[model samples]
Target chain A: MVAALRERVRLACSWCENAIGFIQESRLPNGARRVGAGTMAFRMFIIGLVLVGSLAAAPAAWAYSESDPSANPDIDPSDCESCHTGTPEIAGTEEARQGPHANYSATSRSCYACHQVHQAYADGYLLMPGATTTETCELCHDGTGGKGVYGALEARGLAVASQHRTEVTTQIPGGDEATGGMATAALSGYQGTLSCGDCHSPHGGGTVEPFTTDRSRIETDVAGFFSNQLLRRAPTGATYEIGVYGSDWCAACHSGRASGVHDLINHPVDTSATVGPTAFTYESVQVVDGVDSPQTVQGSLGRSNFGYVMPWPRTAGQGTHAPVCQQCHEDGRSVGDVASGRIKASEVFTVTSADGGTAGDNPRFQNFPHESYVENLLIESYDDLCSNCHHPNQLP
Target chain B: MTPDAAVTPVNSRMRIRRSMQILSAVLLVVLLVLLVLLFRELLTGAPEYPVSQEGIRPLHVILGPGVGNRPFFDGPMGVTFGADGRIYVADSGNHRVVVFDSEGEYLFQFGGLGVGKPAAGIEPSWKPGLFNYPTDICSDDVGNIYVADFRNDQIQVFDADGDFLRVFPDRNEPLGRGASGQDGAGIAVTSLTVHGERVYATDTYQVAVFSTEGELLDQFGRPGAEPGDLDHPNGIAVGAPSVVVVSNSNRNQVLAFAPGGRFMWSFGKPLGNDLAGLSGELELPRGLTIMDDGTVLVADALADSIVRLTLAGEFDGRFGTRGAAPGQFNAPMDVDEADNRLAIAEKGNDRVQVIVIED
Candidate 1:
């Protein structure tokens, strides 16, 4: 019975695909007249095909419940698939099915793995058993589980303890009011608390796994397959890969500097114009046995690589590193202050000297630190930001 | 030898014919299945509306995108009608307050980049008339404009001719200091409403009442989900003489207060599956306004509809549907009642739509 049901579903899916293809092909050219009678007939025919296909897949949906009673016994697993797939199919589920979470392993693929059916612990969406949305993500995102996103965050103290923390109790500097500006309401989407879900979508609809290696190559390979792990994308109508230079996602909430308000007065972001070569770049550091080498390293431009290079376009001739908002600012510093050069150092980067040497090092010459030496999230003073890239001695 | 060769040739021909027949049969079956699927799709038609909006409809939409001679909005958050039947919009994204005539003609604009000058004795760093993100705007009977300069964390007063008047909660005065200290006061003033002699400013947690001259009169309300408590009050309006209404956005309800900061009553249900209803069940209610007839209209952000309620907090009726079409709203952030018309600031669509309310 299972085999037969599988075969039937496969056949139905194939038919549905063909119907969709036919409808797409039947579209009239631009400025053309109304759809012809023949086109209408074809549309009607396609509609009929959808109905029949849904009817055929109905039994297959039921077969999941009939054949596997113990499968996902917490709730009716077929309930979601019934509307999401067989009949009245929701768009993007097919793409979601191809995501890593859905196809990575058998146990992790179920919807119930991340979402609960009733009375969720989180307020808005029914997140799985956890205190908050971030906690729900930490269930599988912890180092031991799979993704290790929380592990990476915790290791860097970005998730907690650091000057910029994602915990609910973290007292954001600005008041929690929708000030029509991004600064005061920076935490709007997070429901008064910054969390992992604010940046990553667990449903795999518009987010990809953070890339750790070979960024440019992986980005080209997954061109239209997924959004960058940061959920960044090129502005609408731009022709670029999924994870290319796009800080508009950050600007969606941080509207002040990122929205071109300080275009003439401050460092440019979300612009195609590249930063001058004087800008700093992220380099890789090689540690020989446990000691760090003094040689400079180069960081990848791909965001998933966690490169120090800002996620903006490089200057054409100068090869300058244009920076995204995240490069110089975090939750602690306001975007306006950062754009105004009031806040120079970023909390994301911290530094510590090795062998009891001076704590500060040219960030461009050293690997990015995991924690800051001072209470503020800065590796050095505001002037050091320029010195890292411009080399202070070179200046007048 | 000739007979054996002929027999082998005939056998080869038969084998080839049988293979061709099998292939033909498979192709025919596939074609039949495709035809069946096409017929089923035709029967299903396009998908039905995700949520029905058959119960309510707007009378008319005005001042929408490309509707008036005024410049289009980048992010319009607040709308109000002046005493002289003119319109004032806190065009937040553009950092200006735009004025339009009663017939939707562009009159003038003020407070753009570098146009602000700080008042004397105020910090030079504070851009006086300039607005960073003006969330809400209100006008008193004498045509005096009150703007909640949200990011600036101060209320700015302007005359009818768009002249800068004075900043509220004066930095030089003790009103700027809260009970804890001067640091915790005067931050995140989201919205404001003007009564007879008072202007109510909604900070994150409490409503700070100020005299028309910018003196802090009294502040009340706290942060919580309980009645009289404001979790995230984003909108404020004056109903009757002493009645004040505030939309607690996070709680998805509107709470009313009488004079002297007494919580009168609260209405509206929490967000749930029921999208259609006459009683006040809101989803992310933001801006609100009170009509002359003591009717309160709240803009439901998620629902894309403006719900009307009586002064007593009873649901009257609602209007609007979710779309980009005229008379429709896409994530409306604020609503104001003026001259038997409703001015709705659509945050998602980046336009202010004025809908005429029919009897």
Candidate 2:
């Protein structure tokens, strides 16, 4: 075995040296003479050496002993670890030591938690035993799956109102056309696509990184650098400090606004904005009926008196909050007084924030209102986008 | 002697050089063969047919412009094979039911506009037999036809010969509102099936049981994702020994219940695309029928095909694709089997096609 390993290493080194020499010789000096016969001969020799080396190493690289317990199964369990972490052969032990699940000593941070060994229920990357990728995530993130960090978000019932609802059924368009049917397109730049795996990697590698716009660019590095909270992209590792508007992750697709093209026309979403007093307070208003007495009804959020914070930026002035795209565009479902039509509202929400956490602890923000009769997935009326921070009656 | 020795040495060198050349040639040939094999494995390409059904083919199709100036179907939603060797179709958009013999001959037609009684406070323009959107049809042993009047919120019964018998729940009773508060009527009967003396119907959320005489016997279901709960239950079928199957379309699962409405077991998962059994999933399942061997055949509207599954909800196989051809379908809504032949109602294409399921 030692002799074979030494021979393989020697062959690899020889192949690399020959390839480099061939490249160096091919480059003629600036303003020098035409290509020479010696250069052609050297190129041929390098090609022959590479072919010979590859032929000799091919069988040794693919060899597997029949008697080995982990050798050559129908579904090679070890193949996943070649690129991903959380497997015995890769960084499973190290991830278990440092990952969020490390404190939960009882939890097994293996790939099996979110993936199946064979015959996956979903199409790509073989999601867990659940039928959908969202369901597999909900098994752990729905408060009952033994994970506590996400339990509060699940308890708020935001799945139906959030823009990133995992239950979206619209088929994503634009993929390999030769397959004869619609293929699953990548999450970035594709509208109406939602799944748990779209934003988070269950293997603990992190989320999808920003790639070039060119479709032909083949990314060799499957696992990019990590970010806090497993975010897809952030300016720095300390993502919580930077508000939702500051992060460039969503800009990968919604380039018009996130890329500052709509900066002047759009409402100010920066962290510097703060909610004024008398914004979210409640009151009853009376209206006269045709018959006799007046009828009283609870006023809308636009007419409220107490100030409330928008729920996107992690930190804002006291009594104020920031907003993200999710605050308005929820799962392509109807919201807030929208007329019922052929399309139906989703029954799940994807974003919610708990109160009493430290500043910049949750990027989703706090005190998100649940679904109401609002149109376009808004948590409140269009007037309330300003009234939630600025008093309607006091507006100029 | 010295000169001979030098020549011998040169001859040996020539032999060695020739041997090296042959070895290089052999290696090049082996490498080329390996490259060819690798390329073949990597680019095997897609299958010739989208769906794999060995010998199935369409035997005939029922097109428009029938005899005696009768109107053809604008959009056909449901189809059923009666015991008397006749095919009944709920010609939904035309507001009628068209009947045809087994040989693709148009036998007769009935239940056109102005054929039924209107409800109180409702205009006389719409009635029970006069369907706004007749979604499903079924038949029993005695050839009694049951038509699900979807918009009318009633089930209109007719004789095998296309004669209107009666309407269930009566026109006088106010239709109860649905869970979504959309239906002002009592129940929105989407699909139904008959077993012995009982009639089972799905009201988009619950399965209501009724006697043959149009009396409500019992009902069980609610809007939920849990067991015994239903979400847009569109299709219903009764299998051997009284097992009731309901296709929960939105949830993308099929729920089974015993004779007394006890939740038995549910199978299928929420898959946006069309697929077959356990590993395969369902999308917008609309109509289903139980075959003689207890296997269930479902017409998946979104998939535009017919999916066959075992009684235990295991996938067998499926056929049909989205097209306007004879063997193809454009949003197939329901499927029924008779005499080893299958009848499909194409809602999008406005036609009825019959095909044989070959072994």
DockQ of each: 0.01, 0.03
lDDT of 2 at A126: 42
| Tens digit of per-residue lDDT, candidate 2, span A323-386 | 3333342212212222211111231111111121112221122222222223434545455344
Mind giving the per-residue lDDT tens digits that candidate 1 earns over A1-396? 123234555766776687677657666677453566444454544466455556555533422322245655765542555434532112222222322233222223235334434322212234344445665454323221122233232331122223334555323332222332324333412456555554444444444333332221112222332323333232222233233323444344333444234433345653322332233322221111111112223443222212322211222322333455434432121111222222234422221211011123222111112223223443344653443334333347
Each candidate's B-chain TM-score, in sequence, is 0.75, 0.77
Docking quality tier of model 1: incorrect
Model 2, position A189: C-alpha lDDT score: 17
Clashes per candidate (backbone, < 3 Å): 26, 24
Q: Assess each prediction's global lDDT (C-alpha) against the native.
A: 0.52, 0.51
